[model samples]
Target: MLYKLNLEHILFLDIETVPQKQHFTELDEDVQALWEQKTQYQRKDEFTPEEFYDRAGIWAEFGKIVCISVGYFAPKGDQRNFRVTSFYGEEIKILKDFKQLLADHFSQAKHLLCAHNGKEFDFPYIARRMVINGINLPYKLDLFGKKPWEVPHLDTMELWKFGDYKHFTSLKLLALVLGIPSPKEDMDGSMVKDVFYIENDLDRIVTYCELDVVTTAQVFLKMRNEELLADDEIKKV
Candidate 1:
């Protein structure tokens, strides 16, 4: 019998992160001094660590979360509904809020959390920051120590390996390779941090995040041998 997944409980999520200013200078002064002299987008230029973050919007003053977008398959439907939420505050409060959302909706379900490179970036970044903030990690995020394939985790980038792992393809590039009409065709991750920092616009961040979740869900669908849905169907929620 084919396994029947509780689709509603599978949370496909992505988080946009810029380095934390507080942690930026933890490096040696020489490195820190060089880093500070340049913008994150400008590698050749020198920067003091502090100046780099100042221009890079790495401090909490630049707002903690630009966006938190999540997606899940709808029960009995061939579609995905994604919800994008924004968190703006100190990292501690934002982490608490993020933990609460998972606790409130997914605490008891057989939840499978999905992300692109979440194993290396999103998951650990959130966990370490949550600990630094004195907040207990949500149960769903406590599976870090387990072997990669043993946990209730799915990383779409890793999933692409089934097709021969043709080099490291970015989520956007993979979508195009699969003819999924790459979302975020207008913007990339580079602009996301700046959208939050310079424009201070939460809606753009939401849009960026929502695009990621939708793309991820599409990638997941393609992996499962299901027909891919259009952007309208994918973003219905």
Candidate 2:
């Protein structure tokens, strides 16, 4: 059962990213050439303008991390309640704070870092940015050389597969299907970078990250047979 484990051992997290814009132009010749060569063919067809920008290292210019939010389920009375928190700041500061928080509160718990589609985007991005900032990673999150099935992670997207893993759905759509209200107020994932970079509205990015985290927590709750809160019960972060 999904709820068989203690609540204290589950940590739900999500991150928002905007590719670096400035740094890519400054990539030394060899690196720049390699990047171009790697993306040359693929960029012509399969990539969206936004994806192209990210693959081109535009997010690196924004310092890699735009915002990161985390939620945890802890015992409360006969039921478990959830707590959520997020940080929006310079990439290094936010990543450092994230590291400290994990070390202080979750260093020893046999916790599973849960997210939707995190294995593909959030996990590697966090690990890369952490290394670039010289921060070591926690053991459960060390993704190097591990097969997908070997990782101690619980991606809602993967779980939704029921082993067929077909017909992947968006987080918003999945949450809606599960009767969880959409957490995003007026923005979408495609607009995250634009909102953060063009509008300079860091709060929106943080909010988006928080939304994903909470929605992900709700997914876990549903999977575990716990009673889900109504739309009115969701408090804005």
Candidate 3:
């Protein structure tokens, strides 16, 4: 079934996010209390809400997207070129640009959004962020009443699960196991917050996000029993 789908119809993507504020104290008193209550189970007694604040980006309510890198296959005759681009900078701007891309190009019913663990993370994160920012949800991201099969989104992690819902696979680990080049050579998701807030390096995060997108596309191709994209075939625009 995966093989039958057109590769060109899929938009592969990855995102980098950071906490809404540089420090937990920066949040208003009310929101800070909310954060503490929200992460109680995960933090337990090991870490205070402030200590666990670095990971706040994992939750849409407390975080904001910094970058969204997308890659799509464009085949010309026998040649395949994977074009990659990113929407970065301000959170609202990033969300608006991504929404525009979805509306302008990938709006058709046949178009699909593909990401590693996207169905669980990327897809919903983008949707929640858009709503929070007052940006209209694109058709691809708006899944209000669509049936499971009618939704046009693909997840590499979900595909690898193959119905074993208990299994969880990190994109870096999956890429390594699948023999595709790892996207975490420079940095992983754990370092994204520091990289963005402390170092103020949006370009670095964008590069990493784009690498993940390319790696995801490669993983999809591997699943389809097709050739993995060569480094030369990937172009970042």
TM-score on alpha carbons, each prediction: 0.73, 0.83, 0.98
Evaluated against the true structure, the overall lDDT of model 1 is 0.65
lDDT of 2 by residue, 145-215 (tens): 97866676778887788877566877888888888766547897778767866799998778778878888
lDDT of 3 at 235: 87
User: Model 2, stretches more than 4 Å misplaced?
Assistant: 22-32, 45-51, 54-63, 143-150, 230-237
Better of 1 and 2 by TM-score: 2
Give the Cα-based TM-score of candidate 3 against the true structure.
0.98
Ranking by lDDT: 3, 2, 1
Ranking by TM-score: 3, 2, 1
Tens digits of per-residue lDDT, candidate 1, 83-110, equal 4455544556768777887888877747
RMSD of each: 5.2, 3.4, 0.9
Q: Which ten residues in a row have the lowest lDDT in candidate 3?
A: 178-187
Give the per-residue Cα lDDT of candidate 2 at 38. Answer: 66
Across 91-134, the per-residue lDDT of candidate 3 in tens digits comes to: 89988888888888999999999999999999999999999988
Error of 1 at 95 (Å): 2.0
